[model samples]
Target: MLNDFSPAAAASSFSPAFSPPEVSQPAPPTFTSPAAAVAAAARLAPRLFEQAARTDEVGGFPTQEFAWLRETGLLTAALAPALGGAGLGEPAAALALLQVLYHVGRGNLAVGRLFEGHVNALLLIQRFGKPAQVAAYAADARAGHLFGVWNTENPAHGVRLNFLAGGTYRLHGAKTFASGAGHITRPLLTGALPAHHGWQMLVLPADEQPPQLDRSFWRPLGMRATASFIASLERLEISADCLLGQPNDYYQQPWFGGGAA
Candidate 1:
């Protein structure tokens, strides 16, 4: 049976540890109507699919196509209405995202998957962040800035995070298959601090350079446009502002975990 991921289902499945702690007020929905958002998604779905082939071959981002995404206001659909977003609930937003992924996958699965990650990051900020944080990210998203999550943990204790004395955090390990790394303006990266309780995510500016980036590692049979390159961080300096939320917000919930793929 095709799973119907409704709001009630989401609430029931949400783990208490991962849930947002009690606050004074609840945030409002960003989308007004599910039907309107789905209709809008349908319009952009075909074009994204049409360009998927070329996007894959070039090992580059579908920049122009994403520009169209911005024009359609689909990019800001995850933000709350107060932050100038569509104000749709999670179920409606996920449905729209599924539609986008379906079309993108028709020509290039890589692009579709990458787009899914981008949307997921936006959803994360919308859900767990403070008002100021949401406003900042929402503004950038509305202005056509792209974002994505960069967490590819392996089964064998692959990744580790370290905290330095000078208010800088270092990522000791490597992240493989960082989809849309090259094209994303912002990367929602996840790593753990040494001796810390859990993992933390940071919104790293994409302009920052990693100590070691091997382009050849990305040479693959498919999904070339994704630029899923391997990058190493001996000791990257990330300011405090780079941190996304409180120490445990990243790994707490499965809501931020699912990708369109």
Candidate 2:
């Protein structure tokens, strides 16, 4: 029930301004300062939870709540302290996200689900992206960019990877159940490569026009607000940098289920 991809509705631009990220932790255990961040979430919990959950039930993204998240330090929880973020690691950040989810769930499941995608997308950028990629995503997020995932393909099968003449590969077929389809500023997408043997991750700038929704139908009973939509790939251009890692890099990570589930 969503509209086709429209470039105009996408974000014009995004950039996050903050100090450089500290290189000390490829992945840290505890937050640089847990108490402070948690305390902050506690204070803003009432408002944040109410807004995100409400919008989820209404079948829309909580734009205002996301803005508040950016204003607050919650959205940048995983970025290093040096980068003007809470610098919380996976575990700590997970805890904070869970708190948000709990509040959202109390209000509505759709909101909690979408929020999880945003958090997971942010976490992936923080964990695997190159320095510049990290900095860019962090900057955009701080500057109010929304992120999500778009991996679920048709119930029949997922996207396929076709071996190309070069070392590169091509993605054929389509993906369904793309949540945050129109609202996200960036989305973590997934597909497979025939040469590789498993799935791969790719970060697409949602600032471009949103993808067109397929008329094909398979509506579920509940979770209507998810806005799960369909999209096709016909010779979409992607470079080596577009690739996240070897096959299955996305699903292999321990934090794969960090916020989504």
Candidate 3:
């Protein structure tokens, strides 16, 4: 858990130098099938295991591991097949994704945990985002941009969204246990809307400055590389399009039911 919604004073900050994400990565490989994607992940697992020892410290991240994932194209494998991916999340192909996760986790849980977030965020956008939204993010994935989901928040002061003028929503409060805090360029965040409006799901803009990270809140017994930290996005304003689906749509079918199944 990310601790409480009440702000924690002890924290540290990490900002990815590559944001607005000008990552220099190779083009993704063409995946022939979900089976091929699984094979690729299986093969890469041990290599990540070898690196796990390196990223096991406080604030460690599987940077090289993810770069390798980008090079191999598993980063984009969850997209629809028509998008030059393996369609890993569809019912017929979902098992392949699970197998990949199993292997990665067997090798290193931190990397597996982060990779799962990347895959699940893509699935959520593909399932709930509009066509233009989907196309734009797919392009980012192909370009090696990592994604994450941040839903946990402070219990006493969970993140909130205040609708504002000109199709904007101002953020309030913080999200705790926010994984990939500084590393992920795109994070799908959940914030409470006005009482009658339910919750809102929104993806922060890729270029938005990194949210404030309180380093003190992150001292897990393990998976420290996951960088699950307290993030306060209070007062950040986002355009309407950043909103993913209707109020409370994040809890809907498929994903809410656990898309991995």
**Colliding pairs, model 2:** 5-210, 5-211, 5-212, 7-209, 15-139, 16-139, 16-140, 199-248
Alpha-carbon runs more than 4 Å astray in model 2 = 1-32, 48-59, 92-94, 155-157, 161-170, 215-225, 257-260
Each model's TM-score, in the order given?
A: 0.75, 0.71, 0.92
Superior by lDDT: candidate 1 or candidate 2:
1
Please give the CA lDDT of all the candidate structures: 0.61, 0.59, 0.81
Span of ten consecutive residues with least summed lDDT in model 1: 12-21
lDDT tens string, model 2, 105-140? 454466556666776787777777888877778776
Ranking according to lDDT, highest score first? 3, 1, 2
Cα deviation of 150, candidate 2, in Å = 2.5
- Using TM-score, rank the candidates from best to worst: 3, 1, 2
Give per-residue CA lDDT, model 3, range 1-261, as digits (tens): 344333445343546633433555447886999999999999998898888889888867888888788778888999998876899978898789899889888888998888888888999999899999999888888887788888887567678889897878888788887888888888898988887688888898645645778766777766888988788886778888888988889889767878434
Per-residue accuracy of model 1 over 1-261 as CA lDDT, tens digit each: 012212122212111111111333323224465455556667667777677667666446566666655566666666666666665436646665565456545545775566677677888887666677778887777666677888884424345667678887766665667666556767787877667667787776655633344445576656777777554544557777677787778766566446423
Please give the range of 10 consecutive residues that has the lowest summed lDDT in model 3.
3-12
TM-score, candidate number 2: 0.71
- The true-versus-predicted C-alpha distance at residue 15 of model 2, in Å, is 19
